[model samples]
Target chain A: MAVREGLLALLDEGPRYGYQLKTEFEAATGGVWPLNVGQVYTTLDRLERDGLVEVRGGAEGAQSQKTYAITTDGVAALGAWWEAVPSDDPPPRDELMLKVLMAIERGDDHALKVVTNQRTVLLSLLQAKRRERRVMSDDSFASKLVTDALILRAEADLRWLDSCEEQLQTRLRAGGTTRPTRKADR
Target chain B: MTAHTLPAPNHAAVEFFDVVKRYGSGSTEVRALNGVSLRIEPGEFVAIMGPSGCGKSTLLHLAGGMEDPSAGRVYVAGRDVADMDVTDRAALRRREVGYVFQRLNLLASLTALENVSLPLELEGVGVRQARAEAREALAAVGLDHHLDRFPDDFSGGQQQRIAIARSIVGRRGVLLADEPTGSLDTATSDAVIELLAELPVRHGTAVVLVTHEPRFASWADRVVFLRDGRVVDDTARTVARSGLGAVS
Candidate 1:
């Protein structure tokens, strides 16, 4: 999703080589959106095949690199995709759920360990993202907006972790075991 | 070691001769299959059993023509698999063989009927006819009520049944099942094995299963044991040694 949007925004700036586009992309994201140079070239090749982009003449020798620019259809398609795109609330794919399910099957202390470790990791990541946001320039509104969104997501994740831990502890104490009754099984 | 002659074309559905598959070169070479040879008859329920890394799964892949043998020839229904081009081999697989993987391999988003209809759809069958045939296949497996349910909503046993329906939907000549009962509980596994046993008898589809469980092997008409890439034992054991007869 980010790749498609970033390519469209870069074309708005001007035409560029594969390597030049990759460098500019990394800089624009403050070096956070790490994209491989090979991936960039591969995606450009696909976009060309899809007729969303076109390659222009090279410097005039076999060793010269071809320059790529977005086609008119590319701009129109990208604009359509952006307008129809749903808000980015990705579904939860929690690996912890699998661990919790297994722990309930085994009826052991493993569930406590898994929840504790997840809490620690989520808290540390939230702190790191907050510190990173503090150092961003206030002058660039776009950069500040992206950073703020990322930090907000991290904060939400941290709160979720807290609630999960509390619920697990309460169940453990009340039931005298970690396993929930089969009726409540997911 | 004596070299065995290939079975007559009409007598065998699959034949393998002195096949060897090695992973790496020189000191790093790992021989996954070493001079293995076997033949499977049409309409026979055969099970290949061995300890882990004994190349049982490799043998199945070779028989199904999904992978090439490093040295020897693999024949499926009298045709040399190695000689067929990719397009022809793919056509043969689609038209003649059905595969049931240990993992259900159902597309999570599609309903049961849609998953069963995939092979026919790939063969250019129109959607209406393909869906009708898929419904018939699901009915054969007693899953008519589940035609509209997504795979994610079903239990493990039901998912396995849906996979079986998908495999046998076309009435393909050969059914290659790689540990079809691996993920189910004992009772469910027994039920699945019974269903697989009934398939060959009812549909005349040759069934070759790769499994490690002794109980599962009991369901086959014949069991061939493998060790270190060679067939070590072949037996006709009608009943499970543990005293569980064919479940009604």
Candidate 2:
């Protein structure tokens, strides 16, 4: 999501300065994403221009710290973003899927090797994530959510690879023909 | 000149001797297995892949002494299961073979620690010793903190791990997992597969798994494919390409 929307959401809580918004954003995301102070200010400036936020006050002088609050428009924008499920009209390009496709298209004995190599890499990644998830405490709820999602996605990918391998072997058994190509999957 | 042929190395952990298993009789007779003979060495992992009725489960049942062959002898850990009494067979299974059933079958009332340790305690291991082994098994499958939780409280994936922990509690020489990851999500399945792959070296256990998924077969040292109650394709090779072999 854009930092613009993020800043709006943070301001929706109440008036907060740029530094505080940056810190809260990182905290909300389990500190996995680091945000820059300059980037926060830049996004906040855009939000103000769009009339989604306004500065609260200049405490002492023109150079005094200023907090920003979300306007009605900002709240509306945040609500819309919350309810909207992001589009998946076009599937994301997956490198492993692409590699398997290329290997199959080339029509050599290399398909098994390619699939095996990719599967090995993914399995190792999955094992590490599982290990991490195992160590997660109840306090690290955000991190736990992130790791849980990761572990599920990794597993889905592995199942997809398993299906691909099964199909490939079946084709080989049926007198060596390439499978009908379909669009890449998650 | 007399030439010496090197004596064959004996490494079979479970050997099937022309085993045949048929159900029903006469016109309705269903031959679930047809003279299937195979061998699994200690510290080696093998997989059985086949269609639903190709007798993969039958083979595993025979290997674990849960079923007797209709026409042949079944040997596990160097003893003929056909010759053993009920108690002897149960004892053999307790000490040598670990079966990871498809249903998980975790005792609902027991805690994860208790469930995993139950098998060891039944085998007459001291309570303290069995609990310690249970702790290590659960930890091996990454369930350290969940030792106190019951199966009802765990996620499907976590419960599966608990099942695995229960299976490996005694460090059994042979592990027979029937569709071990069939109920798991892909990512969680990967973790289970990694653990199965490590069993040979981690606990000195031989694994004979039955999976429809070919990718899981990749983790195994051998793959035996069955069709129409007969062995169609069985291949054995080193697992260096799996990378698990090279990893510490």
Candidate 3:
């Protein structure tokens, strides 16, 4: 998502055509950031409108190729955008939590079965991702980081699921028909 | 049992006992409803009139069991609605109460028939049976012709009629109208009120209408006036004093 601003900053180094910028951008980010030709052109047009970059006329005969250079305003805007841009901290969106809540509301043994099945599937997925991460090259730091984060989150989710199962068992023993009351409601 | 006499077991359709609703807390606390106790009889059509911020809607919501009374109980169809959980209360509303609001809140994407079938679908009724029942309800509202049309395609009165059809489709015993005729012109409002008045006698339903206009309230069997969340006055009459009676 930061590819557009990253490309703009790279263009600040010197005037370059779309393909040249694309290649340099890939090299800078270790190929983690990929851009289609269409995306590159679209970002360029947007940059030009924001007064961050200027599109100079191409060489006399080469009408298809146009060069772009970042303006002083563009450089300032990019710096501001970089400073203003908050770090990505993706929140947990546990579908398992939703499933458990609805299941408890339903107050049936079927919900417990669904939760058990889902946990098994999730554990298998976590193991496979871990195996894939082990074979990945040490140089692919971004790929390794993404995979490690996913595995850790999945493990935490499994722990939560286990606790939920224990809670469900306790509830089932007390009375199968009783509704799960929210703590705040009590 | 005499042929003319009905059973004594049939009690009032609505009862509120020492009901209190407070907003905020401590120094800022505002009591919207304060120990309000009242009963609405079965087969009677009543209108609640009040000024803004007088807890008219809140009272209606409590009577309909949409919200819980902070200190007291609300009973609908002789069942203690306050004792039920939120989900059960919602089910009670779906099965036993019909609500009509000033704004016809019909989904734009769904046709009139689809809108009417929603309550039944939510109640776990079969799709075919729900649709059949929805069709019957629409016909009762004289909207069978407009069943296939979307809410946006119909006029305001027509859309409101569709909303009414949706509310009554489940054959709910108690009809709660919250400013049902607020947005309509005089003629259309009269037409809607006429349809509403006829429903009780026709289907043996109880109606509780909330309105600001005395003219609109005139169509009710009794008018209960609320000022500062308390019933300031109520009519002694047993039927609507207006000229129109039992529409054919």
Candidate 4:
């Protein structure tokens, strides 16, 4: 989704050929978001059509041989992109929360099971992310930033699961439901 | 089995064989651990997790020779704990096992250096020798500059680091930590955990941690899940990683 602005931003550094843009983009993003030559040329064509980029001679489809430079419009668009903040006006739909809600309808015991199962999966993911973070170099800010974001999100979800388990247990102890709480099937 | 009939020694740092611990007798009895068997190898980092009353603490107590089991033998450093007398057990604890509970037991009057060297001093190591080893242990936990400071002089995180330094000071073979980060905030908790993750490699000590926080448990090489006194699941990481190799 940000590929168009990414390409324009790359061009802002000066004119770059198709292959050069692809390698620089991957390097800039820590190689997490990969771009094939086809996707790069497609985005470049759109940018040229919108006047965000200009080809420096040669044929249009001959991307590798042709260089691209950001236009005045491209600079303005890139500035806007830099200033834009991601919006969360409406709460994003989360699959974990949705599954918990559906599980609650089935029963507390079922919901507890779902929470436990999800917790294990998230823990494993967090472990792997931490290991990956451990090996990263001190200067790999891009990778570190992305990895930290992911680790924090997983930790937050695990905390939510803990609360869910606590509430379920509290209700069970108070005899709030008629159904018997089954023994843990773990 | 009698101590004389014990099996041949193996390389496990600690092992619990069909161990059971119960309180009271008959109808009034409550089983804290039920036929649980586990082994922790040298330099292995294991995290024990479970709901309340799931025997996590009991498992730790047995590993440290702090309690006796009703059934099966508990071995530390390949010797049956039941075979040891009280003095031998005390020496075993002083030499082979170290514990860090939620309550940091640093004496208020002692400096960090003294607190770390006290155990060694008690075990009859020369005062100067104990102090030298204490300095190295404190340095391992990043508190070398503050060794002369009393526990009251340090922040919660620094105090925890001191407690950890005390645990590993004498080249103990096993470190049993029970909720060591229970009182710290998230960032401090992470620092404490990261220090713990390094123990196996830095000191060649096997670590057994009991924690309710999955985030902390994720740092371990293996996670053992206990339920109703029995092990429900034991998950090991796909690869074993040492803390020394991680970013500081």
Candidate 5:
């Protein structure tokens, strides 16, 4: 996500320079996303060009340190962003699903390989996310929220994997291409 | 079976491959674990989670050498229990695995120190050395002060902690615990899980915890789910992942 909306949201509170915006953004996000001051300045310049913000004092490095304030239009934009229901249209392109689909089209063992490798990787990711959430949760609600979502999603992915494996095993049984595991009758 | 230590964080301290455990025969047969493949490395924590009779306890038994597999292999600390004779398996069990059950089965007549040291003493360690190690283990779980107290004198959580201290006193390579926190309150459960979670890191003892609770399982590096004797799901995200919000 761009730091644009984040800076605008900060300006909604009060006028602040690039450095202040950067620091505030870090603080708000639990220091998870550390914003570069140069990126902050460039974003501010764009916001100014777009008339979403106005200069309160002067320019960069001024003794008074010119602050940026949200314009009336910026307020409307921030409100719109907040009110906008996030689009799920594109439906996050999952690379593993694509790989599994392609492998199954070949009618071979590659699907099993893809499923097993990804399962291990995702399992490790879930463990790590849970541990991270436990550690950082005390100080940062932002990080806790993000990690919680990650852990939930990872768990769902593992269930999906079980589904995939079951389907493959069924297919294998129908074809009489034998593997060690007996098909679970249930 | 020959028992040799596998390299830490690489080889699995406990392993199962196409494992099947069946009870009874003809007409009354029950498959407790069907073709479950798993690996838990030294310094790792794994939770076997599922509803009751889903084979969670059976899996723990397989890992800890408390039972035999009807098919496939079970490895404990690099030693294949499947190939071992009874004596060899018993030797490997004593040297490599420690079990903590749902009930804190400390001898009611014995004090906390004696309860924790009995396993060591049974393994033929001198009473002095066993008691000293048991004391340290108790201290690790914040139970050193209660050493002279008997199980009857302690709360349920304290008894459980003493059970844990007993399990780890020998520093066995694999700690197989079945519902170790089931009897505790939420806070006590969290504290017990935290202690179990720390075992692998603190003493290089791998843990295979059997829990039906998702929250308790969250402390593990991986949670393996079983259903009707089959491994339905195994989810992992290693706890060892470090850095400034790596996901971010």
Candidate 6:
């Protein structure tokens, strides 16, 4: 959907050959997102079939040479796309959370161990990302931002692990079992 | 052999062997550190992370000879810290230990150069030689041009750089920072963390940083996690220059 919408938005500016669309899209994303010519043309073909774009010129040569222009409908769609915010209607499943829940189901000790083990792995990944961020030149802002997002996500996971540990400890101190126990019949 | 004559094996910058620290007495006694053993090789960067009251700062205090362990031994640059008398400990701190805190204790009135060179001057290094060394330290932190500027004249990040320069000014063997970036904004904190990361490579100083922020801790060559005065985990960075194994 991103590529489909992206190509539509690109065509809205002016007619562009397939190769030009690929280069401009890659450039617009600070060269961090790579789009091959075949994918670009495929997306363009879908847009054309959907009435979002039309073949303008260079139809006699290779697909890369074919110029595509956005239709009137495409302009309206791009405008709507700009105005629309990303939807999170369906909450996404996170693997770490799932792991913690499963571990809790197994019992408190297992959960604590899981959190500690995950912290080790997450810290290793965070260190790698930070090291990569260090080597990046200042001019690569897009690359740095991408790396920053990954780092922040890992940190958040770590904080959650800490919280999990604290909660597990509190339950243990209270002499509570993770699972409910059966009462004896009177 | 006597503790004084025995060097820390393998040239450790700082080493703790079964260290235990307690506060108060008897029923009221709280173990601030419970049998911790760790080592920092020369020029290695290690970060300590944990919940509050987990003894992260206590570990650093012992490393810099600020406090003696209740049991076991602590060594700084191969000297037994517990064996050293008060004056020798003070001398050890002056010559081998440096500390930075969440709040940089930079004197506001002094210029950057004066603040950095003050430690050297206190140790009886001549004013001229101390100032030259301070200049080099400032240059290392990329603040050479602003040597004469007072702390107030610089931005927060620049001020932190000045504080860092002071910590490493005398070529101290160990640099201990307790949440050095706790007061800075994200961008400024990143810059400060980057500067701290450079200390080991640039000066071969063994650096110990205590921080709750994983982002900052990631910059260290190893991360030690403490819980209730015990090390729960110790992880070395995968791409560490020394390839030291985890201590856990």
Indicate which candidate wins on DockQ. 6
Tens-place lDDT per residue, model 5, B78-99, is 6678778888877666667888
lDDT of 3 by residue, B27-82 (tens): 99888888788888777777776556667889889888888888888888878886
Better of 3 and 4 by lDDT: 4
> Which of 2 and 6 is ahead in TM-score?
6
lDDT of 4 by residue, A1-186 (tens): 899999988999899999899999988887788999999999999998999999997765555899899999999999999999988855778999999987886688878777766776666677778889989998888889878888889989988887787788688668757653446522
Cα lDDT tens digits for candidate 3, A77-141: 88887789465545544578888778777665656665555554554455356456657998877
lDDT of each: 0.74, 0.79, 0.76, 0.86, 0.79, 0.85
Clashes in model 3: which pairs? A52-A74
List model 5 lDDT by residue over A94-160, tens digit each: 8878888777755547676577566655665666676767678476777777677777777777778
- What's model 2's lDDT at B173? 81
- Considering lDDT, which of the candidate structures 4 and 6 is the better prediction for this target? 4
Q: How high a TM-score does candidate 6 get?
A: 0.84
RMSD of each: 26.5, 9.6, 23.1, 5.4, 8.0, 4.5
Per-residue CA lDDT of model 6 for B1-248, tens digit only, reads 46555563578999999999999999999999999989899999999988778899999999999998999899899988977999898888878998888898899989989999999999999999999999988898888686788999998889888888888888898999998988899999988888887889988989999998888888888888887788878775332423533422
Task: At residue A20, give the lDDT of candidate 6.
Answer: 91
Winner on DockQ (1 vs 4): 4
Write the residue-wise lDDT of candidate 4 on B1-248 in tens digits: 57565445556999989999998998999889999989998898889987888899999999999899999999899889998999999998898999998999899999999999999999999999999999988998998786788899999999999999899888898999999999999899999999999999777789999999888998987777776688755654222222222221
Q: Looking at candidate 3, what is the lDDT of residue A112?
A: 64
Native A-B contacts reproduced, model 5: 0.30
For model 1, residues B102-193, the per-residue Cα lDDT tens digits are 88899998998999999899999899998998888788777878588899888898899999888877777788999988889988987888
Best by lDDT: 4
DockQ values of all predictions:
0.01, 0.04, 0.00, 0.28, 0.16, 0.38
Poorest 10 consecutive residues by lDDT, candidate 4 chain B: B239-248
Predictions in order: chain A TM-score? 0.73, 0.84, 0.63, 0.83, 0.81, 0.81
Model 4 fnat value? 0.24
